[model samples]
Target: MIKSQVGRRYSKAIFDIAEEKNQVKEIYEMLNSAMVLYRTDKEFKNFIRNPLIENEQKKAVLTEIFGKDSSENLNILLYILDKGRINCIKYIVAEYLKIYYRKNRILDVKATFTKELSEEQRTKLINKLSQKTGKEINLEVKVDKSILGGGIIKIGDKIIDGSIRRELDNWKKS
Candidate 1:
């Protein structure tokens, strides 16, 4: 993923500090809350995302919104966005979550399925995947009807495609 250097730098600095304080999870929650605010508040999102807005104005707006309760380190994060590096927020959050999980030795699994999975199905799959991969998986699920049937399971770089689309591709090849 192409991420702005500012995002990576800010994420790294916060990740490092959070790890040292054993507050990584808490920080992630805080960032997620901020992201939600950015999404839900029209004025807030526009102010941050508008190229016409001055960086100083954006920074001041962020401070007005979050400065008091936000950790000092977290303040730097808003600046990265103010400087027009906001596109990288998603990448930074994902990476920061990965780092947090890695420190806790968790495997973050992303499963794309044709249908919505049941709680029991998710539990069974998590158990099965844990045994196969020898890691505790934090599951992230996405439903894509285009898969037709079954799902694609991704754990880091490895992808296991059991989707019907792949089956059709193989049948065509044959």
Candidate 2:
């Protein structure tokens, strides 16, 4: 969250361009995939962040790893990040995704559950929530066993807590 203001400015600029081009989602997907690839491979992360590696070396490594599959516009965005010394590509990618979602009216919902949900239950819940919120959601579901039962749904900063843990705490205080 504490990314350099410089990085944020550059990211915002590129995000604006992608939005103007009507490729916001595609650009976000590309950036996200690049971040995921960088995260999953230690060597790649090291190569990008290593002070000893020159920019050319870093670019070469990135090219070899990401290949031409990375969109040219995305490459420009990455180049800015690389120049800005914001090695937290994951955060940048995630932040840009949030921007894209906000622009497109796609809400991000995190559903934490004590138990895995069935497809039917998930669909029904999401449908109801979407209707209630009046925004399309891109969900990220988590299995939080410590919830004990039920679940918590977070949209933006609001939390809908239906977990047994909350009920128990309330009961104890009462």
> What does candidate 1 score in Cα RMSD to the true structure?
3.3
lDDT of 1 by residue, 1-174 (tens): 357454566678779977787777677876776777876888788778888888788777767766755466556566566556665676667677766677677898999998889999999999999898787889999999998998999998999999999999999999
lDDT (Cα, tens digit) per residue for candidate 2, span 1-174: 466454466568778888787777677666677778777878777766778878877676656655755457647645755675446666667667667677778898999998778999888888998899888977888998888998999988999999999999999999
Deviation (Å) of 153 in candidate 1: 1.5
Output the TM-score of candidate 1.
Answer: 0.73
Give the TM-score of each candidate.
Answer: 0.73, 0.82
Q: How accurate locally, in lDDT, is each candidate?
A: 0.78, 0.75
Q: Give the TM-score of candidate 2.
A: 0.82
Count of steric clashes across candidates, in order: 0, 0
- Candidate 1, run of 10 with poorest lDDT: 1-10
User: Model 1, residue 32: displacement in angstroms?
Assistant: 2.5
